[model samples]
Target: MELFGQSGNFVLINIVSGNIDFDLRDDNPAPCENIWVGNSSTAPTDGECI
Candidate 1:
């Protein structure tokens, strides 16, 4: 379980809606969603879809 990201502000939401919730602290980076959505080679990020 590992996510790579730079230091900044981000908003996490459940795309399906009302199924999941996410909150990432400034000290803790978020995992890239690329593993679940895009191809395994793309390396998705929390900011990609936005």
Candidate 2:
């Protein structure tokens, strides 16, 4: 799956899996302001994409 759009916010629920991975990319490659990833019950405090 992929996401493409302008600035906005979103929430995901019951997204359970093993060894999940996230990648953020842009055609112009602008700096990413913020991103959050975690388990189904709680939010992640810290993580790195690259």
Candidate 1 ranges beyond 4 A from true positions: 12-17, 20-50
Please give the TM-score that candidate 2 achieves against the real structure: 0.22
Give Cα-based local distance difference scores for all models. 0.31, 0.33
User: At residue 39, what lDDT does model 1 achieve?
Assistant: 20
Backbone steric clashes in candidate 1, count: 0
| Alpha-carbon lDDT of model 1 | 0.31
Error of 2 at 35 (Å): 2.5
Clashes of each: 0, 0
TM-score of each: 0.16, 0.22
| TM-score (C-alpha, index-matched) for candidate 1 | 0.16
Which one wins on lDDT? 2
